[model samples]
Target chain A: MTKKRLTPPLTDADIENLEIGDQVLITGTIYTARDAAHKRLVELLDEGKELPVDLKGQIIYYVGPTPAKPGQVIGSAGPTTSYRMDPYAPKLLAIGLKAMIGKGSRSQEVKDAMKKYKGCYLAAVGGAAALIAKSIKKAEVIAYPELGPEAIRKLEVEDFPAIVVNDCKGGDLYEEGVKKYQK
Target chain B: MREISVEKITRTVRDLCIEAACDLPQDVENLLRQAKEREESQFGRYSLEKIIENVELARQDTVPMCQDTGLAVIFVEIGQDVYIAGGNLVDAINEGVRQGYTDGYLRKSVVEDPVFNRKNTGDNTPAVIHTEIVPGDKLKIMVLPKGAGSENMGALKMLKPADGLKGVKEFVLKTVAEAGGNPCPPIVVGVGIGGTMEKATLLAKKALARKAGEHHPDPKYKELELELLEKINKLGIGPQGFGGRVTALAVHIESYPTHIATLPVAVNLNCHAARHKEAIL
Candidate 1:
């Protein structure tokens, strides 16, 4: 059976070119949200409220950062686990969200959405907050500061490293890698 | 009976929490370097490198090792002869956590309620504290700053007494296998066997505080720990589950006697960055 390679999500090809095991430094815009922000985002879609930012071809990072130190753009910033946001992700993808960034596994429903919508999910190193924070040149909370760490922020990153856990072509590094190495 | 002051214990605990968050323990640091050398997969090697960099950055800059900085969880062993002077012991411990988090510039992740009105407490207060009474005059405190990434994957099950050793092994492997790369591969497996449900969970958490690579005193349990570690690595969960032979840095299991009819088991996964520090007062 012939399969079409899906359209890539980012303005830059680095994210698109990222292999399952290859490390790529990412730059450009990525949005941030956690459990609370995700709930509000889906609610906005239900009420048809205007989204704070247009997600078309945009990546969303699941992170809740510590407060920044003096002269720092942001505090220790690292990705949280992706599973908590799995339930709301496909809905966001259906409406044009292009990418998701976090650590750990995403649900099959979210992976299917990636295939259907031509989106991708990336995994950043889980506990490397300070190193990940260095990639963020700019950060501004776009919504829900009341949620503190869980607030949604827009980050401008440079050469941020991540693994392609799920790609638009339905390739999942987690399962494939496990199967390849399992004895 | 020996008398212990609440203020002294609280002050010591407060320092330990901050220290644990800012400085990756020496043993954990050495292990990461070792894991890097032992990692055959290129991605696994890369992950280990990044982890070492994170540790350096955290120590030099006084930033948290992880964004989660985790909920401040404490395990205390107090001698029956000791007394917490000047105030309630639990309250003092909570105050210590509040000051430690605030002064450390750590993220406040805890909320006032689990369900409605999940409002941030601002200071990361009201810590989850567990106290055990032992026969002695000393106080020992273990602080584990548990990240949500791995904690979300924790599980507990009640097996029939007949399930025995094989059942325990199966439950642990299944849990780790299901976790895949999500718990930040090269994870620490903490297994608690025997005891009631809550006791089992607490035991699993306490097991994590044992120095990495250390095993239980019982020969049977030590063998079980080694076996579980080998089986988990065989899952090929690898570092970050990208594919390698080093899925687990160590497997530490703690057990207690239980009712003849019950076999309660709890498994807690700790990410490679097992941020913990201890102090005795």
Candidate 2:
């Protein structure tokens, strides 16, 4: 498979060019958020309050990284299950969230939002945190530090690998791959 | 009576926690290597290779393999003649967990309350301990750091006696199929049959500690395990649920006697990490 190198903030063209099952190596800046942080982000949106970080054309990684030991840029950091973020994803997508990086299948509603908004969803290898963390060059908590590991972090990554699970055209690797292999 | 100091117990528990988080058990690592060789999908094979690489990195660097260091679940078997001195056994175990999470730089995953307060416990103490009393003068301790990705997908069912084996198999298959990629495949499916509701659940969790690809000793249950494993792999959930021929490394079933009128079944899924370690004193 030919690997594509992407540097966010990704444009609509960047996401639309992707297809399910395409391998990608992402660089540049991405933000991290999990369940607690997502709840707060959505709550802020609901109340017409300002969000701590901008979502336009930005990628979000669903992860809660372990605390870094001395002399490390970051600890073992990998994707969490994506379904838990399904409830909040469409709202972010509506507000110009360009892509999501995590493991597992997204809900149909979230996929529909990706198609409607020209966004994409990617899958990082779960349980491969140490290998994944090696791609991250820098990390700093930017919002909701009170949430601890669930806080939003701005990360500078180089060649961070993931697979395109859902594309703007509504292709789903999980469903298609299962159909191809299932007996 | 054999006297063991509480300090010894605490120290052992702390060490086990640190060790288990950073290292993949040999059995699990071997299974993943085999899965990588057997995986049919290109993406699945790649995922397996990365997982294997991650394990090596974690071990070499003395860092956790995954960010979710998990809630500490300790299984202890105490001999009738062994005595724990200097402190209460439970408190000593919690103290060990506190030190392990703090010293190891593991994540503090536990919240003080499930619903209301939702405050981080900070130290990841008060492990979920399961204790059994046995014959000799030895203390056996096993530490399992269970991540929540797969744990959240566990299921239990109280079936009628008429449901029988066919219904049990169907339920197991359905649970895995519905879980799809959510539990972080490839997963280890632990099925507990018979017993009461809670016992069935505990048995399912206990089944996870068995060596990867190991089956039940009984011939009948062993056959059932193999059959279930075959069905699961056929689902094509693959590694990380992206789809392939290796959805699960093994299917383990543990069962006990049940009442004539009742049938209880539980299913627990463990992700590819399946981290655990043991020591006997």
Candidate 3:
């Protein structure tokens, strides 16, 4: 019932207080990576090698954007399905990745990871590529350019819209929202 | 026999690929409107509205409706009397996919192999093509840009004849309920009943290509579709599975005659952004 727009991401307490289905407009630095990049990062971790980017207090967007057209810094950037990244999320969270942005429900393992690591999961509007892209003030490829669209990129966003799907307090919006609406 | 130029098929197929990728089909647009009106939750209604807006932005601005541009799915109905002059029909379709994905600036998602190496193909070639020979001079082509999310959730089951319609419906509703928000709610449910295992799956996928809200020709199946839609919406999965009364925009069932003791069912889901385009040549 309560709604708030976060132009800049709030504290973990702010995220935990959000009810299921509460709309939020988030502004902050979010990193982009897809299946390929996640796999590589996890592998690097397994080898005890340093990662290309720092995970502390960072948000990882599950996206692979199209080539930027003309003058745009990024192309139709939107969230991919979250489940594909379920396997690696716990490890990333353990490493200090605080927030994950994607669409759809995360598995219990990911939710458990969020609770254990004091991390969160945010759901961006799925399929709203152009609208979502407008939020990005800056975007540049940071690593794995060989993966092209699937590469990891750094994006600075302002008022990027999202909803908290899972929070560190063991709350899950997708589950609660469904139960509330069950007819 | 009628001779058809390979060049024409190649070009037309490419057009279909791009069209299906960039634009949301009109029938689907209307169905989403209806679902929005019927949805009970404010969040579900809002989500549906966002989807409608996304389609317009994608169409007017020439951007992809979804980031997953999807795997190329080609459905070809070749006339028995027609002869393709220059090359193989399948090859022509694949070439069209390559050109369309590259030209449209869509994502190349397919891997060169499934098991190991799993290297990206760069250009999305080798479309999943289903070809059928029918009585006609013209070839009909339908392109469905099927995203991996819903496609990954697709399932096929073989049941004893005793299970019947109720069993089929339960399985479908369970799939949607279990999927929750994963496939992206306000989804279109495509059900294929009968046929062999893989054939049933193919038929289910093809069923999703139909215009949203349209029902099966058979009265019994149409009734089943309506019932399934009601049950799915009642699950309260809502838009993006955040709870709502309009979890499914529509349910479409396609069935075939089956063996005496066997019944088979396949469910293929298409998210709100169901992208499909067709052409005849």
DockQ values of all predictions: 0.74, 0.88, 0.76
> lDDT at A142 for candidate 3?
89
RMSD to true structure for each model, in Å: 3.2, 0.8, 1.7
Q: Tens-digit lDDT track for model 1 on B95-198?
A: 88888887777899898999896899998888888889998888888899888788988899999999989999999999999888888878888999989998
Candidate 1: count of backbone clashes, pairs at least 3 residues apart or interchain: 2
* Better DockQ candidate (1, 3): 3
- Candidate with best DockQ: 2
Best by TM-score: 2
Candidate 2, residue B156: Cα displacement in angstroms equals 0.4
Name the 10 consecutive residues with the lowest summed lDDT in model 3 chain A: A1-10
lDDT of 2 by residue, B188-220 (tens): 999999999999999998899888889899999
lDDT of 3: 0.84
Q: Candidate 2: where is the Cα deviation over 4 Å?
A: none
TM values, all candidates: 0.94, 0.99, 0.96
Q: What is the lDDT of residue B18 in candidate 3?
A: 76
Better of 1 and 2 by TM-score: 2
